[model samples]
Target: MTKQPESSVARPHPGALALGVLGELLITAGLVLALFVGYSLWWTDLVADARAERAGDRLRRAWAAPAAAPPGQAAPAPTYRPGADGIGFLHVPAMGRDYSVLIRLGTGSEVLDGGVAGVYREPYRAAMPWDASGNFALAAHRDGHGAKFHDLDEVGRGAAVVVETRDHWYVYRVDGTLPRASKFDTGIIAPVPEGSGYPGPGRYITLTTCTPVYSSRFRMAVWGSLVRVDPVDARRTPPPELRTS
Candidate 1:
């Protein structure tokens, strides 16, 4: 029998094949980008918050424990020394009623990613909250890793920023704000921060973070003066600034 010529099946065009591959690659890339965003914005916050909570608990436990003193000597005052845990808690009432974050040493990602505000130690040594006449500069993430300063813009002039230590609550009142500053503006953390409307040295608190939301193209700072220091009572009641309705 004469063999009928087998009908040739049409092959996909090269252009169509290339387009299909490109589409698939684009989809994969989009998925990866989305996953990264989710991890950065959500997962990281969860992990950091958990770590911060544990650290905070440990700090509170330590505060509750009675200190040992020599047989005839009184217990010494609480002094801050850099440790793996933390030094204090930051309370920005303008941020929210429950806004609080542990404060640790160093502004590195390793320290900030733990969901805590970091004290600036490079370029300029940030004065501790208890210091008499220097800037207590601090940095925290604005978007992820607890986003401690996400609502920093809301902290207008006269707003309160309190730091809670083992012995005292250092209250600061917002006085100046640089909505946008160069990331390299180290002077903003100086003893008398530049461009913060301060003329000379004094007790100040500077809160800094990435500006314009998720983008880190610039930095934003909120400057404040030491308003008062309230000693911690046995009940540990929050200061008036924090108790406002």
Candidate 2:
């Protein structure tokens, strides 16, 4: 028997092709939206919460000891105490490093403002707190709002910066600057210099950070001797001098 001619099938309609493309576009858009939402929840929104929690933890740890008095005081001051025993705070006036939230050296703080937030400074904890004595080298970001020490270079030699603990304030002079093309072997941080050209002295405060505002190609070191240390009560007044009670 002769085979019947096979029937030809019609091609897909143009409307069907258009519908397929539309379906794919909708799926892609949905996926992108989902990714964005996930990132906001995981990174952007939650990051601040984590950081603020850490800052609070650092603050709480300070003053953990029995309240103590500043040096030369006969006894611990009433209602005034030392930084949570061992940890401390560093304050700077002109560089805006003052009034900054303090955490242990090398520890970080929460981002208070905008894009310039959330960087942890590298600190030398062994050095005495500003209120005490010895060298205190603290490093912060050089640029961005997070760049904590961005304007530190602007400080002229003989200018002053203050470091405050729960108990006292230490005044540091901006005596000199150390320029380096490359970072030195700074693993040996101390109450004494490990030979980065800083002289071992009675008391020194060193400030270090990456230079050129936003670049880390070279580190800029600005440091000076601790001119004096005194009870925070002596001169811890804010520029505005509002009642802090």
Candidate 3:
């Protein structure tokens, strides 16, 4: 008997095959993007937290065991020496009830990447809290590297930003804030930070971070004035302002 004509097999259209491959590629790309975000947001924080803790511990240890005074010289003040590789802790009540982190010397990534705030040490170098008259400027990451200043916007007038040293706690009260500022506005960190609403030379603390969340195009500044200085107690308890939110 004559064989029946062989049935023709149907093949997937070229367009459909191409679309299937494209779908797979798109899914892969999406997954990679998600992983990167997770790493930036969460993993980096984890790594930075560890580094910060180590640095904080070293600071505490140094304070616990200070260098002996030289002969015929009075003991050095219990303060973190500027121009040295000094690192101190900072506490902001409005940032968080338990907000505390080390403040490093420079605003470079080397220091800020440790999940701590860094003082501007370049062209617009910042003054330490211990300075008698000058702006104590600080910079921190707003969204990554522990996001130390992420909640800076929430800090309102009258909130406290306290810097902790071996012996003293420099307490500053929020006076004003510029929600947005140009990134190149170095004057904001000047001894008499302009646009800060303060009239003239006075003790000030300026907290700056990348603004608009998840972007570094602009900056946000929180300006405060020295309200008081509290001596560290034997128990190392924080000041009243840092006791609550």
In lDDT terms, how accurate is model 2?
A: 0.54
lDDT of 3: 0.85
Worst 10 residues of 1 by lDDT: 77-86
Predicted structure 1: lDDT: 0.90
| lDDT sort, best first | 1, 3, 2
Per-residue alpha-carbon lDDT of candidate 3 for residues 68-113, written as tens digits (9 for 90 to 100): 7999897876544332345678899787788998887888787787
Model 3 alpha-carbon miss at residue 108, Å? 1.2
Better of 1 and 3 by TM-score: 1
List ranges where model 2 is wrong by over 4 Å: 1-86, 97-101, 107-125, 130-133, 185-199, 234-245
Taking all chains together, each candidate's TM-score versus the true structure is 0.94, 0.53, 0.92
Instruction: For model 1, give the RMSD to the true fold.
Output: 1.7
How far off is residue 134 in model 3, in Å? 0.6
Superposed Cα deviation of residue 73, candidate 1 (Å): 2.9
Summarize candidate 1's per-residue lDDT along 1-245 as a digit string, tens digits. 99999999999999999999999999999999999999999999999999999999999999899887989999976655553757889999789888899998889998889899999988999888777789999999999899989999999998989999988999889998999999988988899999888988889999999999999999999999998899999999989988966
Worst 10 residues of 3 by lDDT: 77-86
